[model samples]
Each structure stands twice: as structure tokens, then as C-alpha cells.
Target: MSDQAQSTTMTPPAPSDFDGRRAFGRAARIRTPRTSHAVWSPPADRADPVSLLEEQATSRVPDLVPVRHGRMMVSPFTFYRGAALLMAADLATTPNSGLTVQLCGDAHLSNFGLFGSAERHLVFDINDFDETHPGPFEWDVKRLVASFEIAGRHRGFDDKDRRAIILAAGRAYRERMLAAAESTVLDAWYDHLDVDTMQAWLHDERQAERAAKRQVKTFDAVVAKALTKDSMQAFAKLVTTDGGQMRIIGDPPLIVPVEDLLDDTDIDDPEKAAREILASYRNTLFASARHPLSEYTYVHMARKVVGVGSVGTRAWIVLMRGRDELDPLFLQAKEAQASVLERFLEPCEYDNQGERVVRGQRLMQASSDIFLGWQRVRGEGRIERDFYVRQLHDWKGSLDAEKAVPRGTLLYAWICGETLARAHGRSGDRVEIAAYLGKSDAFEESIAAFAEAYADQNEADYQAFTAAVADGRLRAVHGL
Candidate 1:
């Protein structure tokens, strides 16, 4: 609903042209609760996880490949974290509700967190968009709920606890979608997960009231802590003032500088590459976002490895300065690839893969990074890699699953579920999708069953992964 139409005296469309009820009723007739209860059966000739990984490695930086295998070798949860592609392969065979949306592609628990919106408000939403694309909305939910089950196992949670957590997430999705379906389009468009909503849960009000509002002050402290994790904070951590000059510290295989990553005799200049790529990325941003970036100048570039699934990819951090030393901005240029879901669906309409990620993120998120843009860069071998850029740390805070108690995990699960619902509601026909979900726990419970079944498969696959590592078929560089 555009503001122009809202402001004008507009005639409603003809019922045949567009009717929410009719569309909902049509979808309801097509996909029943029984159909949503998808069976998870692997064909006898399911592609081997190790084989998929090896094939994926063909497109990655060969030198950094071992680092990826090492991260996956740490634990079953870690393997699951790095194996979105592998899961997508198996998920392609499962039954779907035929409801499509701009998927987060890898919508796991850890990926949903707080970040600063363009409005300078902290909001929680899906933060990773590397493999985002238009796909069955259920794919994102399946990934999220199954990740919870996998995390529960990693945390040694019992079956009852795991069931409760996953079920809470499912119900949240259902109820949230229903609410969105009932909402007006404008209301849904304006809806967002703001800081106050977060503060309500994060602060212990009872204790705060008992302690003369001393702990109530803790709420402010919490927000401050999250917001302070911006560029200056990253600068303090990664940059050093040595001999009155500031330089980024080099840490091999993880936080090494681009200068260090390149060969000694290489003629290319990293700063030049950063400048060219940043220029290209600037053209991708809207005038509002791009205008502000004009004041900053590039300083340094570092090859920064990041995330469980994103290791071995060509990820870089660019340091830029404005006004003076106090005004520093950090931008992350992370590699983008063909969406894992793309192979299972129609070919992506976008030519540049980086723009594909940016488009999906903008479509699914209520508000996105103002500086969000994409560019393609050529590496040493003239190999092209697409990357999307954004502020590296703008009040970014990811919940550590290892530290989550069962109760906390369940609460977070509900949040993730609701968050995902809002995201899907933005890009898909919420009225029809909500109609398919209906007013019952049947669809919810069925999805839970599917998650449990898939979790079992994930574990079995993890066993095969370890077996390969033990037999030396794949390299494992542990303790990364």
C-alpha cells in the first residue's frame, strides 16, 4: 500500500481481480493440515554430506578450505551451523505448503539478533542473508525450528525440554501470522521489533523494583553495552596505536590483513581494490544511504574470517575515516554465492549474486542497513566473487546458544518464530498462508514432528562426517 493510494480516494479492486478471502479459501482447499505434516524420508541414494561439502569447496578459496572443515569438526551443532547447503539439498525433497516468500535461506537460531535500523533504533530480525532467495516460506521455518532441536541436543537438553522449545517456536509462528493476517497492510508495514520490546524481557523488573530501581538502571546499561559495539569499539579491539600510528593487528588464518594474505611479490594494492569495490557498492545504495558514505575515505582492508557456515569465503573488513580520528566507520564486505534454495526452485531473476542477497534482505526486513549494497571483485586468478557491504558492527549482538538455559532458549525460540512470521508476512500472501495454517496446533505439531525427525537425520549425518574425519578422507584443523 503506497502513501499515494492511501491519501487519495481510491476504488477497491474487483473481487475477481483481488480478494483476500477467496485467495485464502483457495489455498486452504489445496493444502490441508495433513499435507503440511510433511513426511521426512530420505531416498536410498541421498547425496553424501561430505561429497556435497567437497563439491562446494570447488568454488571457495582453496587455502582457507581446511579452516572451514576444522570449524565443522568441533561439534554436531557446529557441523549443522556450517551445512546450510547440505540441509537445503535434503529439504528439497520434503513436501511443502506451496507458500513462497523471500527466505533467509539460512534461518538458524544464531542468525536472529539485534542490530541498529536506519532509524537508529535497535531491532531484532534475521541478520544473515548470504543465501536468501524466493522460496517456500516453510523452508525458513523448517531451518529455524530444526536448528533449535539441534541446539537443544548440543546443550544436552532432554526430549521434553526440546519438544517444549520447538513447539513454542511453532506456535509463535502460527499466532503471529494469524495476527498479521488480521492486521491492515499499513499496520503490518509499520510493525517492527523495537528495543523497548526487548528491554521488557531483558530486565528483571521485580528485582529492580526491590533494589530501589538500581537494577532498573541496568536496563539502560544493557542497551548502552549493545550500542557501544560500533566501529570505535571494533577499532579499540582490532587496531593498535604503535609508535603514534594505528594499524590493524594480524592474526593468521582468522584475522590476517589483506597484505598478509597476498604473496610478497604480488603487484596489486589492496587499498586500490577496496576503493574500486566501494565505488561499485556506492552505486548500488539509494541516494539517502550513498550520500552519507561520500564523507568517508577508505583506510585499510583486512581479510576477516566469519561465521560457522561462512568460513573459507572471501570476507573482508574495510576501515574508513571521516571528520577526524574519532569518526571511524567499519564496513564488512562478505562473499555471496548462489542461493542454496536456488537449485531447488526457478532460476534467480538477478544477475549479480550479491544483489540477490541485498534484495532478499531488504524485502524480508522491516528496516535494513542504510549502507547495505553489493559489488563484485576479481581476485588473483581473475576469479570473480560477489559481496554485499554493511556496517560491520552497528549495535550487533548475537545470543550465545551455549549459554542459553532451557527456559531462555524457549523464550528466544518464541521470539525467533514471531520474527520469522513478520518477515514472511512482509514478502508473501499472509492472508492465504495464514488461512493454510488455520486455527489449530495440528500444523504446528506436525512441523515439530518433522523437526525431530530431521534432527535424527542430522545427527546420523554428523556421525558420517566424523567417520570421514577419523579415516583421514577430509582434513580437520581443530581449535581454530
Candidate 2:
């Protein structure tokens, strides 16, 4: 298909009012142990991807006080990427079982990773939940499948191979969900994948693909790099002298120093104000039953530019010193707002969105960061937004997407499915979703088609964004 013709055909469904229940029926049949769960319908107009993204971004504006103006003018693709929550909203309003647990709305391959669990084990699971909300489990599965298809295309995989990968992922999800449904709640909750367990799992499979083994080795190396004190020092290299005072690089929204962003505030003393904020954040940590910062004392705070999608958003890296200079803890306080799922979901009663994310993360992951917690801050006027805090690099690591092979992708998909099943097992024990999905390859085929369509849409959006950047519609600094 011609690129322009494809663009015209790829225009996603316009935002419209939708009946969530009807959409669910169209998407899949919901089967429960008893009667099927009642599904809430969202308006059809709200399902439009463009509208949903705009709404999600609008809601976050009030809370994103650090860098104003130019931050919002990014290219269309950049904006779309940042607005994943909107994609969640669109997906949630689609047909789904009302059996909802906390969901990692953005359950793409890149979102899964290794992090320090409370047990001190490096567990792998969903690492991002910026759009987490109570919704149908199928939404996450579909999104993940679609992401796989899109990523596969990006890697130049042929259609047949891409379909195989999607099917493998879906089958893995269905089979694992069935197993989890049969397990005790505690057993399912405790089930997690650590490095050793993952290695063993691969070893037993006896797959002789050198490329796959190399990917595993790379993951181990990356984890090793992040775990050492030397790596932390490397991060400190960003810190430089500014007028005789130590400051990290500040480039507007991406990397604004805390002092510059909070300038003209009534707090008189920037350091003191930062300390008070840290105290409030610490209170949140204490409430979570996991204290990663208990041994450390707050020493400094700096604005940090992070993630491809979250680059322009307000994020901070706080430095804490314990025992001495050699002992340090780095905490990330990331700004949070209502997830893209919010508009489509029933209004949440919780006042803090960050807490909502943290709680959802705890529910979805077999293990989570010890310091995960939420804090509410009044930015300007009465505007309020939630912020979740976590240890910056507590043995946390991820695979480099560019280097991942097809089999590596397959293994990653399997792990993702297993993890999703565990998360779904928590809220509803309906073995029917698993049964309906069945051992057959039909569901996977359906998802493969869906992924191809969605990926085409993503490419179109990416192009639109790049065009916007070229036209000077948005200010963007890449490769930071």
C-alpha cells in the first residue's frame, strides 16, 4: 500500500461515546464461575484515540508545574507516545469482563523488567503503570499482543513470523492464566521470576540458539552495571559546577534543576522546601510496609529527564546519604496524574493518583520496590497531582530492544504472559476466560491481525510527530 493511502486507511476510530458492555461483547465473550460480571459502558465518543490523548494530557497539565509552555508542543508522535494512558482509555471502553484487578495499562514488552523485590530478589515483571486502573484483563493482553506485532515489524520480521510470535504470546497467556486460576491465591501471588529461575527455565527448554543465550548474558551484564557503586558515580557525572554550586544539567522540561523550577516561590529556602517535600514523601514510604529509605538521610534533589515517552514530564531524582559517601540511596519521585484509563473508568475514590499507581503496581507485580509510595503536592493555586517515589536503581534492569533477537522476543512474551496471568488471577478466579481462550490458536490469530493494524497506526502517528518537529511546532531535544 502506498504510504499516503495507508495513512488515510489507518486513521483510528474517532472518539465517540461507547457502551462498554457492548464493546466487551464485540471483543470477547465473558465467562465467569457464576453469572458473567456486569460490564460498565463508557461513552462511544470518548474512545477516539486523538480525543482521549488530548483529555489525558489536559488533566495532567495542572499537576505538571515544573516546565510549562513548550513542553506541550512536541511532535504528534511524541505526544501520542506520551499519551499511552489515552490508548488505555480507548482499550478499556472496548468490550471486556467487568472482572477487573489493577492493570498495567501499558503492558508493552518494554514495560516488563527486573527490579529488587521486597525479598531482596531481582524479580522480573511489569515495571511501568502510569496508566494503571481497574479494567478488563483482556485490555492488557490485547495491548501487549499489539505491541509485539508493532515491535516485530520494526525489526523487519515477516508477517508469518510476526503472527507466530503473537500466537505464542497469546497461547502462553491463556495457558498460564489457567494454571494460575488453579493455584492458591497466596501461591499465585508469590510466584515470581528471578534471574536464577529464568536461567533454569531456559536451561530446561534446551534451546540451542546462541543468540537467545547471548541476550540472557547481556541482561545479566546490564544488571551488574547498574548494581555497582561505580555506575551510580557515573550518573553523578551529569552533576557539574554552576556558579560554584553543584547542579545537574538543566534543559527545560527534560532536565530542570529543582531550584530553577521552584523559583519565585514563598519557601525562601529551596533546600529547606525540598527537605520538607522529602519528609512528606518519606511518610508515604513508611505507610507502604516497605522501607528502602529507612537507612538513608535526604541529602539533595535534582530534576531528572527520563524515558522516551516520559521525557518532557516532571520527574526528579533525589539523592540520600547513609552511613557515609559510599553508602547512598537514589529515589525517583515521578509526577503522576489520572491515567488514560480514568476517563473511561468509573471515577476512583482515592484522592491520590500516585497512590493509585503504587497500589496497582503492588497488586499486579509478584514483587515490587520497597520504597514505592504516593505523595500529593499542590503545585499552583489549588492544582494537585500525585507523585510516586521509588528507589532509582535497586538492582533494576531491562534488555536493550535493539539487540533482542526473535527467540529473545518469544521468551520475553512468554514471561509477560505468565506475569499477566498472575496479575489477573488476583481479582477474579473465573477459569472461563482461560477456557474461552482455549488451547486453540484462534485468539492468537485475532491478536496478530489487531497488532498489524495498530502498528500501522503507530507508524503513521510517528511520522506525523516527526513532521511536527520539522515544522517547529514543538521543541524537542533528543538523545539526552
Please tell me which predicted candidate would have the highest lDDT against the true structure: 1
lDDT string, candidate 2, 1-480, tens digits: 111111111122222312332233233443321112122233445544434334444543333422322332333323334657555644544444444556687777778877777877667778898878776676787778877777777677787777778877877887887676456656766766787787666665565563366666766686685455332563475455567644466665555666786663323554675577767777766453445466777666777767655644567777677776556667788888776666666676578889888888877777777678878766445555568988777776776655666777777777777777777766544353554455566566666565666666666655654555577653345434
lDDT value, residue 291 of candidate 2: 53
Q: Rate the local accuracy (lDDT) of all candidates.
A: 0.80, 0.62
Worst 10 residues of 1 by lDDT: 1-10
Per-residue C-alpha lDDT of model 1 across residues 256-346, encoded as one tens digit per residue: 8777866721326677878988877898997845478999988777888898788888788888889977888899998888987787776
State, as a TM-score between 0 and 1, how close model 1 is to the true structure. Answer: 0.90
Q: TM-score: which candidate is best? A: 1
What TM-scores do the predictions have? 0.90, 0.79
